[model samples]
Target: MSSSNHGLARKLGGWQLWGIAVGLVISGEYFGWSYGWAQAGTLGFLLSSIFVAIMYTAFIFSFTELTTAIPHAGGPFAYARRAFGPVGGFIAGFATLCEFVFAPPAIALAIGAYLNVQFPELSAKWIACGAYIVFMALNIVGVSVAAAFELVVTLLAIFELLLFMGVVSPGFSWDNFTHHGWAGSDSFSLSAVGGMFAAIPFAIWFFLAIEGAAMAAEEAKDPSRTIPRAYVAGILTLVALAMGVMIMAGGAGDWSKLANINDPLPQAMKLIVGSNSGWLHMLVWLGLLGLIASFHGIIMGYSRQIFALARAGYLPPMLAVIHPRFKTPHRAIIVGGMIGIAAIFSDDLIQIAGQPLTANIVTLSVFGAIVMYIVSMLALFQLRRSEPALARPFSAPAYPLLPGLALACAVICLIAMIWYNQLLALIFAGSLAVAYAYYLLTHRQRAAAASDVLLEGNDAARLKPAVARSK
Candidate 1:
């Protein structure tokens, strides 16, 4: 498709891109990562988080180079396509879809869980599904309007985290953080080590999907300059928020109580202040902003990805049609929203060895993310060798070293997650196999159709030459 036909408007700037990057991931600070504490105690989870943080820092730095160089709505998919063939592109794109699509349901469920605190009469599932409808509409309206709203909500969410830290700082104690450190053992035992590995996915939740901001590359002005700034600033912001919330919540009280809960931050607020306190109520209400920011931001990410894939002929072409009026990927957004709502309602609560279904979904999302990271990193190396002359306004510092570290860490995380959650891993692998099979079956017909069109044009040209010669 031509650039004009792509239908995405370039209205986003550096700060807006930053807002998207942070907004896409800020929910991690609010919930989900606490599940790491459940698997590994405070210290064990902390260790896992530290490792994951390094991986993200390296990955973001290298990923920025690809985003600026390619600057496509498909993000990693575009990069992988350029480096490998159509099959590589499909793998990257499908993984990205998994990461962005699965994340929203988890965030939506959290939104419902947060709202459930105020209204016990309503079901969390219903609230979550309703949130999908509302946000998907906002996204379909326009990118600028949606991004501006994302920035405002993301800022508010950031402030709330700082507020939580200040409120609980007085009650913070080292003993609480150290209590049951290393998975409740006096020292790091084999089980503690196993728990640390199991905690990898939850630690990943702390920084997952931040890369989704790169999906906005096609919509950003001066992407070469803006993308790098947004990526670096966004990762730094998440690292700080992730560490702060974890420590503050853990130190506030018995950290174990906070684990595996949907509303860990608000629950921590209750521990620091009375449940009836106005502060607790305020936190609960304001905490919804965090969920809203991530939910809305990720919805934006997934729709653009779907739009890009469809435009590139990987999926159904209908999804590529942009709203002529709104100038948005309305079809893609609605389709993705339907999938998210279905996931929420499916309520697939198959527990694998004591892990909750929510955590399993989280593991699935991380599995997708890990796949993208590994493939994208390899694509980086491949592109450097094959497309050495390609314009790279932003280059990854330290070359092979940084990208290599990122790839290594991603592989480690992938292995750890598979070993820890074999059932979830199997499900994810099966889904990928199905997606690839469909792609292979359909892509051949598309190729044949294109060949037929080319042959028809050649025939027309030959007839024109013969008619002229006879005249």
Candidate 2:
């Protein structure tokens, strides 16, 4: 419990962690996944989604074992560090930072787009920047307060999705879904298969960053029990909601029409009820809740990841400081918020080769996610062999089989994205190279400082004693 003194209040339980998990991902249900439809059409995207869903289901089950056993704010970073040493840990932590940090600006832009539907005069960029300021302030106040707000917004967002399904269900048509089934191909061919491969990132959008719930382990009450339950409940809820929203939207009208748009759900709602109808209006207002839930939740996620890395000497120590009164990672949260806001304003629509900037950012984020997934799965197997007596409150069901499959699926997704987004892939690789080089130059000094702090009865004492007792 050295982390308790690190200043984060462990007020979250199963329900609150569930909210953070679902909230972190619910925006996917509202927007980004439709870009898959743009790539492969309805049938193509649906097939891609099925494979991604299988990957996520397997990964989540295995990931919970690490979460419960390690129960650190670093999440995958901690797992990799324990199993692979500093190098592997930095890779996992950096990838996680990329995944959580890059995601929010996209969601914030979507929020701006949603509001633009109502008030056409206000600029989306300004609106998004303003949102970051407001939510970041809310987050800096306290973990319990921020999580409670997340739960309320997450519930409202979930209700809005269900309400959307109900209204659009009656209008669903089989022909509309199949109209441009394989990106307008006459039938399934080699070209169609290639498109499906290209669509993997967007299909992943449906469940991307759901693992963020694990980042809250340090803030969760009885994380060994609460983390697994929240993860299980959260993924199930997302699977059901993702499938429902995709099917309803694709079947309601020409699926192609909604593809690649920033606000697919609202557009789909307009198909059933006219553009200016009350239903459409309701969706625009309530839909902001979905974007807010994710925008808020991911801010919480990235701050914790930054805090963990800083605390472990992988980043600037300043980021590790917790607020005295608020007891939150205020510095970490502000740093992440600043980065996201910068991304929002840099609205470079230029395509890297053929991929748009937004798609490129999303692709970069997925690249990070896939790397983390691969490393974490590898860490799980390594830990199993290396620490046979490790206290695991919850074991991954089916053991090697599930973790193995998760690894394979993640590897495939990473390959697909590289093939489709070569330039963005290179950019991501370059960023990692720079970060790793920096780590190599400074890690020894930081580690020495960290060791000194640990010996002085600080947060590291909490971790050292636990491991010693276990040995």
Candidate 3:
């Protein structure tokens, strides 16, 4: 098939790119970050959050370099391939695939849990499955339409978070937030430091998947311009919102009560306004927009990844076939949805170390994400040395400093998560091993034979018009 026939349509502009970037992660604002409270009390998790925020700030700033220079849907996968060839591409691609594929089920379950707040009789698992089906359909219809929907829901999600902060201001109390804040102790001790590191996965949940926006680079109308604007703005917005919302929730009431549950905001609201308040009701309803936004956006991310990998013969080539009418990766979209739904069903079937199923899934996803981040930063350094003339519309500002900072933080998070969740880490490692073995046996030769043009991204000649316009 021709590239024209299979290529994703360029329909996303800067604002739309912002939507995907934020929408891909806005769910963290809603439910998952509270899990950090369980691992580290408010003070300890706060420390963890700050650490993660620093990592993300460095990662996104440096990552924008790869997105603009390559502008491929494969994202970190493409960058690694360009830097180190097929083997590196497969590792990054597999890690990214794990991150994107595993995330939505967790988000979908959150969506089901939110709706179950109003309708207590419904099964959250089935509802999660239904969500996977509905949003996957929406994603399959068209990227422009999906992106338009993403923008609206992401805006609403952002507004709802800000409103939560405003609504809780009356009851906010620093004394309440600070009391027993450091892992249930008034002051930090050596043991509390353990909690801080153990909380790294959930702290990461605060801004996870923001980099998924880079997967949409192929569809971005002007990647070199839109990606930097979208990414830089997205990171800053998420950091402010994450800290603000966490602080507001902690100060509202018994912070311990909000730690273990999935619906922290509504529970925090109830602590102040009682469960019957209209404000609480509004949050329950409007909060779905945040979960839905991330759920839907992640479906878009994983599908594009699957499409990219399959197109390169890393998976079945049929997944690369774009829908003629919709011009979307319809097959990839459906396949990923099936995987997510299956994961939702497996929640009851699998138990790891008595941990809640959602927490386990979150840890797994974070592991994949951290690995991909490490690989991507290394790719950035390698590309700098190898592809010296690659048209970089946005360079990593501090070169080795910023990218190295990102790499160090990612490695720390990976180590922390592995220490805290050894069983899950083993599972993730084993899966990666199995997948790589399969690739070597079945697809490595084809990947080796594929053209290096996409891998090298020596597209200076093609980027001439865009560069001229920029100049």
Better of 1 and 3 by TM-score: 3
lDDT of 3 by residue, 1-471 (tens): 236546888899999999999999999999988888887899999999999999999999999999999888888988998888778999999999989998898998998899999999999998898998899999989999999999999999999999999999999999989889988899889878999999999999999999999999999989999999999999999999999999999999899999877889999999999988999999999999999999999999999999888877788878888998999999999999988888999987999989878888888899989999999999999999988987899999988899999999999999898898889999999999999888888653343333436664665356445434543
Report the C-alpha displacement of residue 121, candidate 2, in angstroms: 0.5
Error of 2 at 254 (Å): 1.3
Clashing residue pairs, backbone N/CA/C < 3 A, model 1? none
Candidate lDDT scores, in order, read 0.88, 0.88, 0.90
Query: Candidate 1: which stretches are off by over 4 Å?
Result: 3-5, 348-354, 444-471
Decoy 2 TM-score against native: 0.95
Ranking by TM-score: 3, 2, 1
The 10-residue segment with the lowest total lDDT in model 1: 449-458
C-alpha RMSD values across all candidates: 5.0, 3.6, 4.7
Instruction: Give the winner by TM-score.
Output: 3
Candidate 2 residue pairs that clash: none
State the lDDT at 252 in candidate 1. Answer: 92
